[model samples]
Target: MHAWIIWLPVCEAGRTFGMDSLGGWMFWIVCVCFSVWENAALKVNMRESSLEVVRGDSVILPCSFYTSSRLSTLNIIWTLARSSSPETPIQVIVYDYGQVIEDPSLIGRVAFTGLPLSADIILNYTRLSDAGTYRCMVNNLPEKADPGIGELELSVLEPPSLPDCKWDGDINLGGSVRLSCSVAEGVPTPDIRWEKVNPEEIPLPINMEGDFSGSVQIVNVSSQTSGLYRCSATNIL
Candidate 1:
Protein backbone atom coordinates (compact mmCIF):
# COMPACT_ATOMS: atom_id res chain seq x y z
CA MET A 1 0.00 0.00 0.00
CA HIS A 2 2.82 2.40 0.80
CA ALA A 3 4.73 3.69 -2.24
CA TRP A 4 8.16 3.33 -0.58
CA ILE A 5 7.53 -0.28 0.56
CA ILE A 6 6.15 -1.31 -2.86
CA TRP A 7 9.07 0.25 -4.66
CA LEU A 8 11.63 -1.35 -2.33
CA PRO A 9 10.71 -4.92 -3.36
CA VAL A 10 10.52 -3.96 -7.05
CA CYS A 11 13.95 -2.40 -6.87
CA GLU A 12 15.51 -5.38 -5.07
CA ALA A 13 13.91 -7.94 -7.43
CA GLY A 14 16.32 -7.03 -10.26
CA ARG A 15 19.73 -8.74 -10.40
CA THR A 16 21.46 -5.32 -10.55
CA PHE A 17 18.65 -3.39 -8.77
CA GLY A 18 17.66 -1.78 -12.10
CA MET A 19 20.65 0.59 -11.89
CA ASP A 20 22.76 1.50 -14.90
CA SER A 21 26.58 1.51 -14.65
CA LEU A 22 26.64 5.25 -14.01
CA GLY A 23 23.59 5.16 -11.74
CA GLY A 24 25.19 2.51 -9.50
CA TRP A 25 28.27 4.72 -9.05
CA MET A 26 26.11 7.76 -8.26
CA PHE A 27 24.16 5.90 -5.54
CA TRP A 28 27.37 4.84 -3.75
CA ILE A 29 28.75 8.37 -4.09
CA VAL A 30 25.73 9.79 -2.32
CA CYS A 31 26.10 7.36 0.61
CA VAL A 32 29.81 8.14 0.94
CA CYS A 33 29.15 11.86 0.93
CA PHE A 34 26.55 11.60 3.73
CA SER A 35 28.88 9.44 5.85
CA VAL A 36 31.77 11.88 5.48
CA TRP A 37 29.59 14.84 6.39
CA GLU A 38 28.39 13.15 9.58
CA ASN A 39 31.93 12.29 10.67
CA ALA A 40 33.09 15.88 10.10
CA ALA A 41 30.23 17.35 12.12
CA LEU A 42 30.90 15.12 15.15
CA LYS A 43 34.63 15.98 15.20
CA VAL A 44 33.88 19.69 15.37
CA ASN A 45 31.95 19.72 18.65
CA MET A 46 33.31 18.06 21.83
CA ARG A 47 33.71 19.17 25.47
CA GLU A 48 34.53 18.09 29.08
CA SER A 49 32.93 18.72 32.50
CA SER A 50 33.26 17.54 36.16
CA LEU A 51 32.05 17.65 39.82
CA GLU A 52 33.08 16.83 43.44
CA VAL A 53 31.43 15.72 46.73
CA VAL A 54 32.15 14.78 50.36
CA ARG A 55 32.07 11.15 51.51
CA GLY A 56 28.73 11.34 53.30
CA ASP A 57 27.08 13.80 50.96
CA SER A 58 25.48 13.14 47.59
CA VAL A 59 26.58 14.69 44.26
CA ILE A 60 25.39 15.24 40.72
CA LEU A 61 27.75 15.03 37.72
CA PRO A 62 26.90 17.15 34.67
CA CYS A 63 27.23 15.79 31.13
CA SER A 64 26.10 17.61 27.97
CA PHE A 65 26.91 18.15 24.28
CA TYR A 66 27.01 21.08 21.85
CA THR A 67 26.11 20.51 18.18
CA SER A 68 25.50 22.98 15.39
CA SER A 69 22.31 21.16 14.36
CA ARG A 70 19.44 19.79 16.49
CA LEU A 71 20.42 16.43 17.98
CA SER A 72 18.43 13.33 17.05
CA THR A 73 20.53 10.73 18.81
CA LEU A 74 21.39 10.45 22.52
CA ASN A 75 23.79 8.32 24.57
CA ILE A 76 25.12 8.89 28.09
CA ILE A 77 27.25 6.75 30.40
CA TRP A 78 28.45 7.15 34.01
CA THR A 79 31.38 5.19 35.45
CA LEU A 80 33.29 5.00 38.74
CA ALA A 81 36.97 4.08 39.19
CA ARG A 82 39.07 3.75 42.32
CA SER A 83 42.15 5.96 42.67
CA SER A 84 44.38 3.12 43.89
CA SER A 85 46.02 0.39 41.82
CA PRO A 86 47.06 0.57 38.14
CA GLU A 87 44.58 -1.78 36.49
CA THR A 88 41.94 0.96 36.04
CA PRO A 89 39.25 -0.68 38.14
CA ILE A 90 36.13 0.89 36.64
CA GLN A 91 32.45 0.21 37.34
CA VAL A 92 29.51 1.36 35.26
CA ILE A 93 27.19 3.46 37.36
CA VAL A 94 24.67 4.38 34.70
CA TYR A 95 24.12 4.00 30.97
CA ASP A 96 21.25 5.79 29.23
CA TYR A 97 19.80 5.75 25.70
CA GLY A 98 16.43 7.54 25.98
CA GLN A 99 15.88 5.57 29.26
CA VAL A 100 17.93 5.26 32.42
CA ILE A 101 20.02 2.12 32.90
CA GLU A 102 19.12 -0.14 35.85
CA ASP A 103 22.06 -0.63 38.24
CA PRO A 104 21.39 -2.64 41.41
CA SER A 105 23.76 -0.59 43.58
CA LEU A 106 22.27 2.70 42.37
CA ILE A 107 18.61 1.69 42.24
CA GLY A 108 16.22 4.37 43.56
CA ARG A 109 19.29 6.59 44.08
CA VAL A 110 20.13 7.81 40.57
CA ALA A 111 18.27 10.25 38.35
CA PHE A 112 18.79 12.16 35.10
CA THR A 113 17.92 15.79 34.49
CA GLY A 114 17.16 17.74 31.28
CA LEU A 115 16.67 16.49 27.71
CA PRO A 116 18.64 13.87 25.80
CA LEU A 117 21.18 16.31 24.35
CA SER A 118 21.86 18.04 27.70
CA ALA A 119 21.50 16.51 31.15
CA ASP A 120 22.80 16.31 34.72
CA ILE A 121 22.88 13.16 36.89
CA ILE A 122 21.99 12.93 40.59
CA LEU A 123 23.03 10.42 43.28
CA ASN A 124 21.14 10.18 46.59
CA TYR A 125 22.01 9.11 50.16
CA THR A 126 25.69 8.65 49.39
CA ARG A 127 27.90 6.28 51.44
CA LEU A 128 31.61 5.48 51.88
CA SER A 129 31.21 2.66 49.35
CA ASP A 130 30.48 5.37 46.79
CA ALA A 131 33.87 7.00 47.28
CA GLY A 132 35.91 7.08 44.07
CA THR A 133 36.65 9.03 40.90
CA TYR A 134 33.78 9.06 38.39
CA ARG A 135 33.52 9.75 34.69
CA CYS A 136 30.46 10.77 32.65
CA MET A 137 30.55 10.20 28.92
CA VAL A 138 28.07 11.44 26.28
CA ASN A 139 27.73 10.55 22.62
CA ASN A 140 24.91 11.88 20.41
CA LEU A 141 26.68 12.27 17.12
CA PRO A 142 25.40 11.30 13.70
CA GLU A 143 28.54 9.25 13.16
CA LYS A 144 31.06 7.40 15.34
CA ALA A 145 32.64 10.18 17.44
CA ASP A 146 34.65 10.74 20.57
CA PRO A 147 32.49 10.93 23.70
CA GLY A 148 32.33 13.97 26.00
CA ILE A 149 33.98 13.41 29.37
CA GLY A 150 33.17 14.59 32.92
CA GLU A 151 35.09 13.75 36.10
CA LEU A 152 33.74 13.50 39.65
CA GLU A 153 35.27 12.97 43.10
CA LEU A 154 33.54 11.36 46.08
CA SER A 155 35.12 11.77 49.51
CA VAL A 156 34.31 9.31 52.32
CA LEU A 157 34.76 10.02 56.04
CA GLU A 158 35.65 7.38 58.61
CA PRO A 159 33.21 6.44 61.40
CA PRO A 160 33.78 8.10 64.74
CA SER A 161 34.85 6.09 67.83
CA LEU A 162 32.31 4.98 70.41
CA PRO A 163 31.86 7.47 73.29
CA ASP A 164 32.24 6.47 76.96
CA CYS A 165 29.04 5.71 78.96
CA LYS A 166 28.43 7.51 82.26
CA TRP A 167 25.77 7.67 84.99
CA ASP A 168 24.84 10.45 87.48
CA GLY A 169 25.56 8.25 90.57
CA ASP A 170 25.53 4.74 92.06
CA ILE A 171 22.21 2.86 91.87
CA ASN A 172 20.47 0.94 94.69
CA LEU A 173 19.49 -2.74 94.18
CA GLY A 174 15.89 -1.94 93.19
CA GLY A 175 16.20 1.70 92.09
CA SER A 176 16.02 2.76 88.41
CA VAL A 177 19.12 4.13 86.58
CA ARG A 178 20.25 5.22 83.14
CA LEU A 179 23.44 4.68 81.08
CA SER A 180 24.51 6.35 77.81
CA CYS A 181 26.90 5.92 74.87
CA SER A 182 27.77 8.40 72.11
CA VAL A 183 28.85 8.41 68.47
CA ALA A 184 30.59 11.41 67.00
CA GLU A 185 30.34 11.22 63.18
CA GLY A 186 30.47 8.89 60.19
CA VAL A 187 29.84 8.99 56.44
CA PRO A 188 27.23 6.25 56.67
CA THR A 189 24.56 6.83 59.31
CA PRO A 190 25.62 4.65 62.22
CA ASP A 191 23.40 2.13 64.05
CA ILE A 192 23.79 1.77 67.84
CA ARG A 193 23.61 -1.44 69.85
CA TRP A 194 24.06 -2.03 73.62
CA GLU A 195 26.11 -4.86 75.10
CA LYS A 196 26.08 -5.56 78.88
CA VAL A 197 28.97 -6.77 81.12
CA ASN A 198 27.33 -10.20 81.46
CA PRO A 199 26.74 -11.99 78.17
CA GLU A 200 23.55 -13.68 79.48
CA GLU A 201 22.08 -10.40 80.74
CA ILE A 202 19.66 -8.76 78.29
CA PRO A 203 20.03 -5.01 77.96
CA LEU A 204 16.93 -2.77 78.18
CA PRO A 205 15.06 -1.75 75.05
CA ILE A 206 17.61 0.40 73.20
CA ASN A 207 16.31 3.66 71.71
CA MET A 208 18.28 4.66 68.57
CA GLU A 209 18.64 8.10 67.03
CA GLY A 210 18.62 9.26 70.60
CA ASP A 211 20.08 12.38 72.15
CA PHE A 212 23.86 13.14 71.99
CA SER A 213 25.32 12.58 68.54
CA GLY A 214 23.18 9.65 67.42
CA SER A 215 23.63 7.56 70.56
CA VAL A 216 21.72 4.49 71.82
CA GLN A 217 19.25 4.59 74.75
CA ILE A 218 17.69 2.14 77.26
CA VAL A 219 14.50 2.92 79.20
CA ASN A 220 12.92 1.54 82.47
CA VAL A 221 15.94 0.79 84.70
CA SER A 222 16.47 -2.57 86.41
CA SER A 223 19.32 -4.33 88.28
CA GLN A 224 19.78 -6.89 85.51
CA THR A 225 20.53 -4.02 83.04
CA SER A 226 22.86 -2.18 85.48
CA GLY A 227 26.20 -3.71 84.40
CA LEU A 228 28.66 -1.90 82.10
CA TYR A 229 26.64 -1.01 78.97
CA ARG A 230 28.81 -0.89 75.89
CA CYS A 231 27.45 1.34 73.06
CA SER A 232 28.49 0.24 69.62
CA ALA A 233 27.72 1.89 66.24
CA THR A 234 28.05 0.41 62.78
CA ASN A 235 28.10 2.75 59.80
CA ILE A 236 26.19 1.92 56.62
CA LEU A 237 29.35 2.60 54.64
Candidate 2:
Protein backbone atom coordinates (compact mmCIF):
# COMPACT_ATOMS: atom_id res chain seq x y z
CA MET A 1 0.00 0.00 0.00
CA HIS A 2 1.23 3.57 -0.86
CA ALA A 3 0.32 6.78 1.01
CA TRP A 4 0.27 10.28 -0.58
CA ILE A 5 0.69 13.57 1.27
CA ILE A 6 -0.53 17.06 0.18
CA TRP A 7 0.48 20.45 1.53
CA LEU A 8 -2.20 23.17 1.53
CA PRO A 9 -1.67 26.81 2.36
CA VAL A 10 -3.65 28.51 5.12
CA CYS A 11 -5.54 31.72 4.34
CA GLU A 12 -6.13 34.10 7.26
CA ALA A 13 -7.35 37.64 7.61
CA GLY A 14 -9.57 37.02 4.54
CA ARG A 15 -6.75 37.39 2.03
CA THR A 16 -5.67 35.29 -0.97
CA PHE A 17 -3.35 32.55 0.26
CA GLY A 18 -0.49 30.72 -1.37
CA MET A 19 2.67 28.77 -0.46
CA ASP A 20 6.21 29.90 -1.30
CA SER A 21 7.30 26.26 -1.65
CA LEU A 22 5.00 25.80 -4.64
CA GLY A 23 5.58 27.25 -8.15
CA GLY A 24 3.76 30.40 -9.36
CA TRP A 25 1.23 28.34 -11.41
CA MET A 26 0.04 26.39 -8.38
CA PHE A 27 -0.08 29.56 -6.30
CA TRP A 28 -2.51 31.29 -8.70
CA ILE A 29 -4.91 28.35 -8.85
CA VAL A 30 -5.24 28.36 -5.08
CA CYS A 31 -5.59 32.13 -5.08
CA VAL A 32 -8.56 32.03 -7.52
CA CYS A 33 -10.42 29.49 -5.41
CA PHE A 34 -9.97 31.49 -2.22
CA SER A 35 -11.20 34.60 -3.98
CA VAL A 36 -14.41 32.90 -5.09
CA TRP A 37 -15.21 31.72 -1.57
CA GLU A 38 -14.46 35.08 0.03
CA ASN A 39 -16.52 36.98 -2.52
CA ALA A 40 -19.62 34.96 -1.67
CA ALA A 41 -19.58 36.39 1.86
CA LEU A 42 -19.23 40.03 0.81
CA LYS A 43 -21.83 42.73 1.42
CA VAL A 44 -22.66 45.54 -0.98
CA ASN A 45 -23.21 49.23 -0.18
CA MET A 46 -24.67 52.06 -2.28
CA ARG A 47 -25.19 55.76 -1.56
CA GLU A 48 -27.50 57.19 -4.26
CA SER A 49 -29.48 55.45 -6.92
CA SER A 50 -30.85 58.41 -8.90
CA LEU A 51 -29.44 61.70 -10.09
CA GLU A 52 -30.44 64.64 -12.29
CA VAL A 53 -28.06 66.96 -14.09
CA VAL A 54 -28.01 69.62 -16.79
CA ARG A 55 -26.12 69.50 -20.06
CA GLY A 56 -22.38 70.16 -20.20
CA ASP A 57 -22.01 69.27 -16.56
CA SER A 58 -20.44 66.50 -14.47
CA VAL A 59 -22.13 63.61 -12.68
CA ILE A 60 -21.08 60.81 -10.35
CA LEU A 61 -22.20 57.20 -10.13
CA PRO A 62 -21.74 55.68 -6.63
CA CYS A 63 -21.24 52.03 -5.69
CA SER A 64 -19.38 50.15 -2.95
CA PHE A 65 -18.70 46.73 -1.41
CA TYR A 66 -17.31 45.42 1.87
CA THR A 67 -15.88 42.09 2.96
CA SER A 68 -14.35 40.84 6.20
CA SER A 69 -11.70 38.90 4.29
CA ARG A 70 -8.92 40.54 2.29
CA LEU A 71 -8.69 40.01 -1.45
CA SER A 72 -5.33 39.66 -3.15
CA THR A 73 -6.79 40.82 -6.46
CA LEU A 74 -9.91 42.95 -6.49
CA ASN A 75 -11.85 43.66 -9.65
CA ILE A 76 -14.18 46.66 -9.80
CA ILE A 77 -16.30 46.41 -12.94
CA TRP A 78 -18.79 49.02 -14.11
CA THR A 79 -21.25 48.42 -16.92
CA LEU A 80 -23.97 50.51 -18.56
CA ALA A 81 -27.41 49.31 -19.61
CA ARG A 82 -30.72 50.89 -20.58
CA SER A 83 -32.17 49.41 -17.43
CA SER A 84 -31.16 47.20 -14.54
CA SER A 85 -31.22 44.06 -16.62
CA PRO A 86 -28.26 41.73 -16.89
CA GLU A 87 -29.27 40.79 -20.43
CA THR A 88 -28.37 44.23 -21.75
CA PRO A 89 -24.97 44.68 -23.35
CA ILE A 90 -22.57 46.06 -20.75
CA GLN A 91 -20.44 49.09 -21.64
CA VAL A 92 -17.33 48.52 -19.57
CA ILE A 93 -16.12 51.66 -17.84
CA VAL A 94 -13.43 50.52 -15.41
CA TYR A 95 -12.10 47.00 -14.90
CA ASP A 96 -9.44 46.35 -12.29
CA TYR A 97 -8.33 42.87 -11.42
CA GLY A 98 -4.64 42.13 -11.58
CA GLN A 99 -4.41 44.75 -14.31
CA VAL A 100 -6.26 47.95 -15.09
CA ILE A 101 -8.07 48.11 -18.44
CA GLU A 102 -10.08 51.11 -19.56
CA ASP A 103 -12.79 50.71 -22.16
CA PRO A 104 -12.67 52.79 -25.32
CA SER A 105 -16.28 53.82 -24.77
CA LEU A 106 -15.13 56.11 -21.95
CA ILE A 107 -12.93 58.13 -24.33
CA GLY A 108 -11.09 59.80 -21.47
CA ARG A 109 -14.36 61.27 -20.24
CA VAL A 110 -14.95 58.80 -17.45
CA ALA A 111 -12.82 58.74 -14.27
CA PHE A 112 -12.79 56.49 -11.23
CA THR A 113 -12.78 58.46 -7.98
CA GLY A 114 -13.68 55.67 -5.58
CA LEU A 115 -10.57 53.76 -4.64
CA PRO A 116 -10.23 50.26 -3.14
CA LEU A 117 -13.75 49.82 -1.77
CA SER A 118 -15.90 52.17 -3.85
CA ALA A 119 -16.55 51.88 -7.57
CA ASP A 120 -17.87 55.37 -8.23
CA ILE A 121 -17.32 56.87 -11.68
CA ILE A 122 -17.42 60.51 -12.75
CA LEU A 123 -18.48 61.70 -16.19
CA ASN A 124 -17.24 65.04 -17.49
CA TYR A 125 -19.00 67.38 -19.93
CA THR A 126 -22.15 65.32 -19.86
CA ARG A 127 -24.39 65.21 -22.95
CA LEU A 128 -27.88 64.00 -23.84
CA SER A 129 -26.53 60.56 -24.64
CA ASP A 130 -25.50 60.10 -20.99
CA ALA A 131 -29.09 59.89 -19.78
CA GLY A 132 -29.78 56.29 -18.80
CA THR A 133 -29.28 53.62 -16.14
CA TYR A 134 -26.03 51.98 -15.00
CA ARG A 135 -25.04 48.94 -12.97
CA CYS A 136 -22.01 48.28 -10.82
CA MET A 137 -20.89 44.70 -10.39
CA VAL A 138 -18.18 43.13 -8.30
CA ASN A 139 -16.23 39.95 -9.00
CA ASN A 140 -17.77 38.40 -5.89
CA LEU A 141 -19.31 35.22 -7.18
CA PRO A 142 -21.85 33.22 -5.15
CA GLU A 143 -22.29 36.37 -3.06
CA LYS A 144 -23.07 38.58 -6.05
CA ALA A 145 -26.82 38.78 -6.41
CA ASP A 146 -28.12 42.20 -7.45
CA PRO A 147 -25.64 44.89 -8.47
CA GLY A 148 -25.60 48.50 -7.26
CA ILE A 149 -27.24 50.96 -9.66
CA GLY A 150 -26.94 54.63 -10.60
CA GLU A 151 -29.68 56.03 -12.79
CA LEU A 152 -29.35 59.52 -14.22
CA GLU A 153 -31.81 61.62 -16.19
CA LEU A 154 -30.27 64.45 -18.17
CA SER A 155 -32.15 67.52 -19.40
CA VAL A 156 -30.85 69.92 -22.01
CA LEU A 157 -32.29 73.35 -21.27
CA GLU A 158 -31.76 76.58 -23.18
CA PRO A 159 -33.61 79.89 -23.34
CA PRO A 160 -35.95 80.80 -26.18
CA SER A 161 -34.26 81.66 -29.47
CA LEU A 162 -34.77 84.55 -31.90
CA PRO A 163 -38.46 84.93 -32.77
CA ASP A 164 -40.27 85.86 -35.99
CA CYS A 165 -43.64 87.57 -36.33
CA LYS A 166 -45.97 87.51 -39.34
CA TRP A 167 -49.59 88.25 -40.09
CA ASP A 168 -52.14 86.06 -41.93
CA GLY A 169 -53.82 88.98 -43.71
CA ASP A 170 -53.39 92.71 -44.35
CA ILE A 171 -54.76 95.36 -41.93
CA ASN A 172 -58.28 96.40 -43.00
CA LEU A 173 -61.60 97.34 -41.41
CA GLY A 174 -64.11 94.52 -40.72
CA GLY A 175 -61.50 91.90 -41.77
CA SER A 176 -59.99 88.87 -40.01
CA VAL A 177 -56.25 88.91 -39.22
CA ARG A 178 -54.02 86.32 -37.45
CA LEU A 179 -50.62 87.06 -35.99
CA SER A 180 -48.16 84.13 -36.36
CA CYS A 181 -45.05 83.81 -34.22
CA SER A 182 -42.14 81.35 -34.38
CA VAL A 183 -38.53 80.79 -33.32
CA ALA A 184 -35.62 79.04 -35.05
CA GLU A 185 -34.34 77.02 -32.10
CA GLY A 186 -35.39 76.28 -28.52
CA VAL A 187 -34.30 73.54 -26.09
CA PRO A 188 -37.70 72.53 -24.70
CA THR A 189 -39.41 73.92 -27.83
CA PRO A 190 -40.37 77.51 -27.17
CA ASP A 191 -43.92 78.64 -26.49
CA ILE A 192 -45.04 81.46 -28.79
CA ARG A 193 -47.41 84.19 -27.60
CA TRP A 194 -48.97 87.28 -29.19
CA GLU A 195 -49.69 90.45 -27.19
CA LYS A 196 -50.94 93.87 -28.33
CA VAL A 197 -48.07 96.32 -27.84
CA ASN A 198 -50.37 98.92 -26.24
CA PRO A 199 -52.25 96.11 -24.36
CA GLU A 200 -55.92 95.33 -25.20
CA GLU A 201 -58.37 92.45 -25.51
CA ILE A 202 -56.68 90.44 -28.27
CA PRO A 203 -58.11 87.31 -29.87
CA LEU A 204 -57.50 83.97 -28.15
CA PRO A 205 -54.28 82.16 -29.26
CA ILE A 206 -54.37 79.19 -31.64
CA ASN A 207 -51.25 77.08 -32.08
CA MET A 208 -50.10 76.32 -35.62
CA GLU A 209 -46.99 74.08 -35.78
CA GLY A 210 -46.84 73.01 -32.17
CA ASP A 211 -46.50 75.75 -29.54
CA PHE A 212 -43.55 77.19 -31.48
CA SER A 213 -46.00 79.06 -33.69
CA GLY A 214 -49.36 80.52 -32.60
CA SER A 215 -51.97 82.80 -34.14
CA VAL A 216 -55.18 84.52 -33.05
CA GLN A 217 -58.03 85.42 -35.45
CA ILE A 218 -59.65 88.85 -34.99
CA VAL A 219 -63.30 88.51 -35.96
CA ASN A 220 -63.81 92.21 -36.62
CA VAL A 221 -60.73 94.36 -37.23
CA SER A 222 -61.10 97.93 -36.01
CA SER A 223 -59.12 101.04 -35.05
CA GLN A 224 -58.75 99.55 -31.56
CA THR A 225 -56.65 96.76 -33.14
CA SER A 226 -54.45 99.33 -34.89
CA GLY A 227 -51.85 99.01 -32.11
CA LEU A 228 -48.45 97.41 -32.92
CA TYR A 229 -48.17 93.67 -32.15
CA ARG A 230 -45.38 91.96 -30.25
CA CYS A 231 -44.45 88.26 -30.38
CA SER A 232 -42.46 86.60 -27.60
CA ALA A 233 -40.98 83.09 -27.44
CA THR A 234 -40.36 81.41 -24.08
CA ASN A 235 -39.37 77.90 -23.04
CA ILE A 236 -39.56 75.79 -19.85
CA LEU A 237 -36.18 74.88 -18.46
TM-scores for all predictions: 0.44, 0.60
- Over 1-237, each residue of candidate 1 has an lDDT whose tens digit, in order, gives 111111232244455453444566666767776666656533222233334455546776665655544455666677777544325645455444556774676787777766655656677777666667766666655545454665666566666566666655336655545566667665445666676656564544575545434333444557655556666667654
Index of the highest-lDDT prediction: 2
Model 2, stretches more than 4 Å misplaced?
Answer: 1-40, 69-73, 79-92, 98-105, 141-143, 146-167, 182-192, 200-204, 211-213, 233-236
Cα misplacement distance, residue 127 of candidate 1 (Å): 0.5
Which pairs in model 1 have colliding backbones? 55-155
Residue pairs in steric clash, candidate 2? 14-69, 14-70
The local lDDT score (0 to 100) that residue 122 gets in candidate 1 is 73
The TM-score that candidate 2 achieves is 0.60
- In model 1, the runs with Cα more than 4 Å from the true position are 1-56, 83-96, 144-147, 158-237
